[model samples]
Target: MRIVPSEISSRTRSAAERSVFAALKAIPDKESVALHSVHLPAHRYKRVGEIDFVVITPELILFIEVKGGGIAFRDGKWHYGRGDGRTETRTEGPFEQASSGMHELEREFRQAVDGLRGRDAVGGYLVVTPDVDLPPMTTYEPEHYLGSTAYAGGRGLEAAIRRAANHWRGKGKNRSALPTISAQLRGDIVKAIRPEFDLVPSLHARITDLEATFERLTTEQLEKLDELEDNPRLIWTGGAGTGKTFLAAEAARRSSARGTVLFTCASHTLAAHVAGVLSADSIVVLPFDRLDEVRGRRFDHLIVDEAQDLMGFGHLEKLEELVHGGLDGGHWIFMLDRNNQVLAPAGYDPEAWKYLRDIGAMNASLRRNCRNTKQIVKQVQRYTGADLGIPMAGQGEQVVFAKVTGREDEAAQLDRHLDRLLDDGVAARDVTLVSSSGDWDNTSARLTRRFSRIDRYADTIGAGKQRNRITWASVVDFKGLENQVVCLIDLDAEDLRGRLDAVYVAWTRARAHLWIAVLPGVNHALRELGVAALAREGAAE
Candidate 1:
């Protein structure tokens, strides 16, 4: 049937609808088939369904239900919806509704045909949705009819009609004439319609899928890391143990071939760690303060490892100048922790948080903690608001809590615990000691001198100062850093109030194991925020 385009409204049908309508108009017909968008008779008992397109033919009638949403098949059902401000409600399954509509159309067409020619005729149901990558249909059972893309092409409708006519012709004992009738239908429709279906592989789609797969890969590798092509800017954020450092190293290694890649960290320790992983001649790992001096030199990319500590707009502006000014046409990779900005400068406006929303950023959350058990991660999440995204499967280590009378006693208790853990085969290198107060140098010094482990300062831990031994560091210095085991000491301070963010940073630093030493007056603003006791209790099995 000749499908007319003028009958349908351009306003009502979406972009996809117009495309489908244009395709349908190319089909030739024995008789003119008019397409219409008519409101069905209202049902007081049930909600009336709005038919997207209706085709009235000489011998048969067809009703089409269109869904423009990208169709997805799941759990033995098809699902599709659009973002039209209305919450989509799946009333009946698409297959069931299509079948029912087909049956109704057949009955209606029989009546219409009988009134005109005194004979029952054939009818069909069509469910049309464009731009859908539908799965191959294996069955055409009574309740599971799937429309193919091939049917929507030049000879699609005619081919469908021929199939229907063949079945009817068999029932009428005129099976020999079925072939002739099908040929006539095809000859009439196939020539007039111009089929313009393009089937080329989309490069953009392939690239997107590849990027998703890269993000989900489990193995540690330096290959297949994509550097931004134009206006390259990069931001990487992950909780502790998410391999942000390793990913940064990989980025450095891949981009080093293009030009000089400067690896800078907010602290020296992180820079040192990254420096150890890179070729000394290719990368210049430095602290954030030294960035200004290196501005005259040209670099292709800047990889910032401990970006969480690069707080305040001033620091960001300086980095931006170094990037957009010095390395005018370069890329950047920033590794950040949301809760890691503990030492916000005096009068730091909260509005500066908006700087975190800049473009060229990727969020790669490390779901599995290679260090801590699921129970420990959960407990830590409860306290520090770190969503580990891990479901508990079984029992794990219990989180232990002891309230000390003072800071000294707390430090001693922490030392005793460390001694016991070391005796239990927990290497000092596997553990990190964190605290809010930087004055814990005395405690850290005692631990360091006794155990021969270095005290890690977050600012000095990044590059050129890589210490393989266990270390003590303040939460601020260890913001974007993580370890297998962590012992938080001297965190229970009254003066260091409004530092729940610091507490969160310290708590998340431990990947596999965590130990918190709380002083007697440790019930500070952080504990009030449901972070301290909650995270500790939650982490404990």
Candidate 2:
């Protein structure tokens, strides 16, 4: 059997529910899939119900309601004891809860999926009490309930479920026999029941998973590194999320094995980030402006990340002087994003790029995006006109767009988003708050007053402060760095449109999720660019 979540969530509090979830995994049927804690929206008299476990097999779909601790019924009421030595009363018992949730699930399934209302789908409900061996109740069928005695190393639980399924299979008469639920229909039912809930893991889990996968050099990046074997001087160009900075740092790390390597980038923040990652004693990571420290000194090799920002004749000349053999004879590698050249003060210089090529530097274009997810790449392309390669990451959370009326509204919306993210188990450090307002005064006042825990990314890196706190950053300083979650706030249409390159860089800074708070004008501009505007605030694709 396959579990929808693959692992039981840490948030699940009920011990009995956890036991049932584990027992469901013991089902011998290899094709079965069990979804735990399927939440159903409130409807009519029901105040939002949760089905403990929904087991979908090739033959039937079964909903299980579990009662833990001590359970008893008297005076038309049910009492459940807690591990904390407390008792809670409920008017409806486990059997009623199971039946109500099962019917509600069926109704929701029919409404969500097309052509499924008329199809005879086999579904039943069962009540499980893992800690109590309840006597047979006259109100419900004996096969529909499982006591503690029935949990014989999970095999007895499996037997009870099979018996309940058979009961439903036998209930149908000759004229209207229960139809055999095909595997395709069962899969469709599973999707219709809990599509997003079953697929999207907690934000904390996503960050850990994505960061683990991102720590290594991708196959394409390794292949690009191989090019350095023959050509010491190489120019690697790509759009955002294409792993340009990663390749640059890795190149520096490899070259450090041979000789002294000077790895540098435009942003001081980015330089600090790369410095922490590559700790080779032979490698020196520094910002471009700090090159004066080694003005008269020479390095065996030069590796520049975010090289697009320093593609000026003067900057290239300085770099040439710093290398042991100068530009033409020196061994060096330049990694840059051509699409983000506008982010630089002087912008990219065509003559300087030509200068590198004229000196026998091999150019390699990275087209596989190793950072952002497919949904984020789609959003970036639609708004910024930046094709960040084919996204090779997971199908992450959808890009969210929140329409705000003013600065106050933006602040309020961001607060709401932050609360939700915190609830989803995302750490404060995993989120970076990006201000899109051109003027600092236009956006900084309310944010600073509202979020006291937020520290500037540059300051955090410089001061060596604890990173367990949220960080704020300007679009330019956050150019080569990425977080699991990013919130782009205070977007002004005119300001954003003027710095499309900055917008490109800011939006791509999120590896898994991107949440944008857009003003009316900015929202309209995105719509004009064929980007779908959010129908409502906080709506995601």
Candidate 3:
């Protein structure tokens, strides 16, 4: 029930357009439609022709033009005037004007939109306000422009609109949904009608900003990263969202200045993603399993994130081989925080830590959780079955948990929280949507029109310049990245079944807040973590 490019409840700027919009509101299932005023493009001929409205019903996209005020079409021409018997002011024909405007839009659309053009799905009509009338050229138009098109008065408006919508039903990929729009389609249409943009997702802005406000760094860690640039061995530890990976990248960049740095992540997705985002000179981000490629080559230093996952994925010896042979003095940094949060069957044994310690590596831990609020950390501890007496961080809003019955309910719940955050000044870039649920297509299509699916962690900020949308990551994708807020979707007993650590990681990703949509059966477990399921305002039980 939105009027695209503007608020639906806001008053329309044009009187004639307002009348048409009011009539559209009277159509059946009007709430299922979106009324858009395709801001008219610049007219080179100095003749004003507007696309007026692009109505998106649940079935199809109906682009309608409103030629209001006192106007008429007589003979083979179009005319306009105050109609005070000052004769008539002849202008461009309404059919020709709207048709050309729509034609121009379609052309722009072909470039901006992806799955359009060949679908033969786009076509619209010309509508005159009740006060205006024309025996305009309604039928002698192009075949593509004549699909149930109409020019008529107020009462007949709904029927014409319906016919226009029904015209494109069952075409192309729009099977049962017919004219329904996906988030991508909505983005394309809005972008096409608007001015061209070079804007990236707002998240990128937040990320650039986060770099300036450095995470809570300790003096010992600072000395290790900057002061002891020659320190050949070190182990960094922190709980979830403690900025371990960020520091590792920072260390890698500084270390690279001295010589080539080899950076490694745990998962392939995480490694490729890190490779995409990390831009430090002489640093190559790779998966730990791929470390063998650099066996004979000497790297100035080595930085590894998610050491636990790496320990489980590949052997520590592979990493040892890289250090033993290459670099000046075996400079290496291993960042780890297991928190007993392993999703797979793999577990990190004391032997892993003992091996590094045996090599004279200094141990340093980040005591504070900089990525998540205190409440979020508490909730993570709760869900992980951490001892009740364990200390907690005192910041962040109480984790909000709302029970959902199924997929649809979960989606609606997520949307509400996201909208609330956006309205509350949370940048889109600072948000991460984490879910282990397999329903990515249905979930992502609904949650975001723009997002970066970070299958891996970036080693540096501002590495990849995709649209600045929020990050939609799988539980596996969110290894070292932290966000201002995280909305964990599809949480259930099944998700916490064997890998509470995955759930722990998801909850801790949020810096200021954590919103949970728990499918019914799972709440029993989450309830033990002190989560209360309340009905949102105006939400159905």
Best by TM-score: 2
Choose the strongest candidate by lDDT.
Answer: 2
Writing each residue's lDDT as its tens digit, candidate 1 over 1-541 gives 4443232331243655555565556566645443433221221111113344445554334555556666666666655666474434464655457557556544443444323234333445555555453554653332122254654533354555445444434555555532321333322321221110101111111211211111222322111132233236666565555556666765675466456778887766556555555653667778787787787675667877766666567776676665533323347777665434323334343455455444444434444444356766666566555554443223556666666677567756776777888899976666777766756545534543354555455533443343445677877667656666778776656634755567556776765667777665665544555655555556764
Clash pairs (backbone) in predicted model 2: none
Structural similarity to truth (TM-score) of each candidate: 0.50, 0.58, 0.52
What are the lDDT figures for the candidates, one per model?
0.53, 0.75, 0.57
2 or 3, greater by lDDT: 2
Model 2, 1-541: lDDT tens digits are 6665444544456778777777887677777777775232212223223577788876678988888999888998899998899999999888888888888877877788664778766778888888888877776888789888877545688788788878876675442466776777777776665443432222222222323221434556645765765687888889888888766765676577568999988899888777766666888889999999988889999998888888889899889888889888999998888775534435778888788778856888999998899999988777666658989987998999888888787788888888899999998889988877534555643564447777778776766555777778888788888888999976788765556676788899999999998887886777754442222212532
lDDT: worst 10-residue window of model 2? 39-48
Rank the candidate models, highest TM-score first: 2, 3, 1
Distance from true position, residue 326, model 1, in Å?
6.9
Candidate 1 segments whose C-alpha is farther than 4 A from its true place: 1-224, 227-231, 311-313, 324-329, 340-372, 388-396, 444-470, 523-527, 531-541
